[model samples]
Target: MRPDLRAHALHWHDKTRATQMEFGLWQVWEAGWVTAILRGASITILVGLVSMAAGLVIGIVCGLIKWARIFPLSLLVDAYTSLVRGVPELLIIYLLFFSSVEFVTKVVTAFGYAGVAESGYAFVIAVIAIGAISGAYSTEVVRGALGAIPNGHIEAARALGLSGGRIFRRIIAPQMLRIAVPGINNVWQTTIKDTALVSVVGLQELMRISFIGANSTRHPFIFYLIAAVVYLAITLVSQAGFDAIERLLRVRTRK
Candidate 1:
């Protein structure tokens, strides 16, 4: 190689090394980046919790209707569960986000509701989309739980002249929930991971923030690693909660 070319090559190599090294240097002692990642993780947890709550309601309602074989509603419930389970979750999020905006805009304009801002539209869509998909799986869990309840217990409840609400709340809900714990735990874990997909729609969840950090610092490895560790920590904590609930319910059953 020519002398000038060799010197330029060496300089370029050293510059690249320095840039890579910056990741190590900053990550070791930088509190701000750590805080940013923590904040992002908080958003991820909030979204997961909200989505799970919505999903449980949807699942319970749909499961009950389908379990009873309610006429036309049963067919509609079947279609919803089939569609959500058949489609990719990311595609659902994208569809909801785009479609909901147009929908809300038209509804608001039609009703003469002024000042409809989209500041939180993405977050709303994320929760609803994730919930819709999670609910489809949860429907099976709830239905199976309901099926496992002996017909005799329901007959006894009916014989006792108990109202429908009392029978369900006192005799059915508890047993069904105990049976559904493991399934719901699986759903919660899946829903948590699914929040990462919402980052694609520009929500500032953990993955999106980590992606931004990676590009800004030219340190994809470190940022992605942090995000992974954060996600695992959240999962571990959530698992512990579910485990405790399962243990409590089991003890109650033994008693």
Candidate 2:
């Protein structure tokens, strides 16, 4: 090719590349997507935190029942854990959402507030479904942690005349917590990502918002990339916090 023709081709290539890069970046900020994404992220975090907390409570109770081998209740807990863990999470969400919405709608309607049921039900269902799933995993975590406690410590406490509650408070509880932290953190990470599934029910979490933005802007790649980054940020921050807590617990155990 002639020198001038080559220069013209090179210029067009550069211009086209710049335009493509600009379009990609532009799509990310169009339509106040950043703000929308932030809002959705907040909801995701909120749902995750509340669900994890609920799951922890459920897990502790069921785990204790299982650990104590408490007859029929333990059997029920086993069934629950098995049922939840055995099923696909999305299937559980679908079953729970579709099955309970009618009852919830009736209950809400009886109180004279009718407008918010469908919208409100989505969040409730998200929490219930995710919490139930998280709890199943957490139950095993707690059960494992409980089993890890050396029987010798409990026996020593008993020999020292400590009551069951007292021994649990001073010896069993702390050790169990220390043993359980890493497992709980793992559950939390899974739980937060699981929030994405709730988007299917119209919960408007980060994933859902990203999907909407991608569709609206016709730039699925950029929007999804942003969603990935946001999820990564949340995970990194949560991991750091859990690591700190683990370190603190280790220091306390030493002292």
Error of 1 at 159 (Å): 2.8
* Highest lDDT against the true fold, candidate: 2
Measured against the true structure, the TM-scores of the candidates, in listed sequence, are 0.84, 0.90
lDDT of 1: 0.88
Instruction: Give one digit per residue, the lDDT tens place, for model 1 in 1-255.
Output: 999999999999999888777855486348477777788899899999999999999999999998889999999999999999999999999888776677776776677665234456668878999989889999988988999999999999999999999999998999999999999999999999999999987788899989988887767888898899999999999999999999999999898
Q: Write the per-residue lDDT of candidate 2 for residues 188-241, one digit (tens) a residue.
A: 999999999998888888999999998987778888888999999999999999
Candidate 2 Cα outliers beyond 4 Å, as residue runs: 1-18, 102-119
Give the Å shift of residue 221 in candidate 2.
0.6
Which candidate ranks first by TM-score, i.e. highest? 2
